[model samples]
Target: MSDSNTTVFTNPSSFILLGIPGLEVAHIWISIPFCAMYAIAVLGNFTILLIVRMETSLHAPMYYFLCRLAVIDLVLSTVTLPKMLSIFWFNSREIDFSACFTQLYFIHCFTVIETGILVALAFDRYVAICNPLRYSTILTNRVVAKIGMAVLLRGSLLTLPRPFLETRWPYCRTNVIAHTYCEHIAVVKLACADIRFSSYYGLLVIFLVTGPDVSFITFSYIQILRAIFSLPTKDARLKTFGTCGSHLCVILAFYIPALFSIFTHQYGHNVPLHFHVITANMYLLLPPMLNPIIYGVRTKQIRDRLLHLLTHKGT
Candidate 1:
């Protein structure tokens, strides 16, 4: 028994990330789209950050939350994608123990922080629509700063236990992570011990963060819609709803894919491994890529700013 434990530490213990398991022959081919998406995701989110910073007119609560969200998206896209592209482009799949855990921490941290920012944005919309008279007074600069800090600290604090949890388990089984990114459970599965505690804690964290977050955001929108309908003018109704349309679309895009991935991971026992892994990858990458597009196309201010930048560059 002691000999086995010693062997587990000294053997081929570094994780071999099986990125799209059976598609080894086609990995180089598959890298093309991944590379393109990574570039777009990084560039788009960076543009959002830059526009928010440079445009003094955009220093409102809405744009402030957006700035925070853009930061999270950039980190999320950056942390997960380069390594994944490396897997595809160069077949670099071996990840050491501490490195894998570090990746896992940031991946989840960004996810939870994204949810918090979405909720913060939802509250901003709700106040704007429901109590327009006090919107500015209520969500002042100080209040907005507090909320941003809260979102950042909350995500950091909640997931702080992850490294400790991961450290408890020793990897003695095959060190091949089934997915490209270092997901908590995927890494935990490589442990030889029972995983009930880790699994339940993970579920608890997900439910605690995402459950209330989704519900709160949905409720905020419901209130916003009702307040819009109460407005007397048709133009008022259209303008107010249109203002929120982009956020609504964003909520749907993010949650639909995320929920589907979660259900498929938990219940789709007979699903193909590559399909599951690819879907997981999509959940992380797609939002970062599409979020900037959705905001740029739907939000007039961002759209006009982006257009002005482009036309100026063209000239």
Candidate 2:
């Protein structure tokens, strides 16, 4: 163990990720479900992209947003899963210093992008249902392109500071991280220098992303509900509600685990370290795995097109 005075500002060339602290014995067993989730997420997200790409009838603001989401989910899962599996399956726990920060950047970057996309999707649904006549006029291809650009730009700019901030800290305490992957907070905690700024900045990033996005999504849904209830008949109301249900489910799937993980990591004093690790991984995995399935089952066009593709692929 190196002391703070001697090792201050001496960055290690590489860091050892402990996979899951206290669960080394069960790493192999834990990997089984993680592998399954990764496989399903990859296949499902790729299938979603392929289906959206090939179907001209599916060309609309909603489907376009869904494609953006599929791409985000694909990249998000790809960023963390393989490395995690390597640690678990092959015992490859060492990650280069720069590589760890890179992983940290992409993981948080795409997560913020996904949140923005979800908000955009909610706005799309709000326009489609609440202002049907203006839907085409409002969310044109140009407008959608701009929205996509904004989401990417915001996510990139916000998360770009994370690696820089983390790298500034002197890792004199240890190079062993208790988590499976290079999570920003976990990596920052190893620093011997004052980490208060890093911690506050992390909270700031979370607040800036979640504060406005959640408020907007909630406002959109509230208006959507008002529009839904004012429908002249029961069937009309049901139809509108059903249309928004899948997006609602996806939003819940994304936010619930994510918020839980964040809160537990920050404040859950009694929570086991293993539980934090598992929840962190789950927040990343569950949304990507469930998003496509929820959309496929809930959206009639996607369901029919997916079924058609599967059935005809054999012939």
Best TM-score goes to which candidate?
2
lDDT of 2 by residue, 35-91 (tens): 999998999888888898899999999999999999999998998999999999999
TM-score, model 1 to reference: 0.94
Candidate with best lDDT: 2
Q: Candidate 2 — which residues are off by over 4 angstroms?
A: 1-9
- What are the clash counts of all predictions, listed in order? 0, 0
Query: Which runs of model 1 end up more than 4 angstroms from their true locations?
Result: 1-13
Clashing pairs in 1: none
Per-residue lDDT over 54-113 for candidate 1, one digit per residue giving the tens place of the 0 to 100 score: 788998999989888778888988888888888888888888777788888898888899
How well does candidate 1 score on lDDT at residue 248?
Answer: 81
What is each predicted model's overall lDDT from 0 to 1?
A: 0.83, 0.90
CA RMSD of all predictions = 3.1, 2.3
TM-score of 2: 0.95
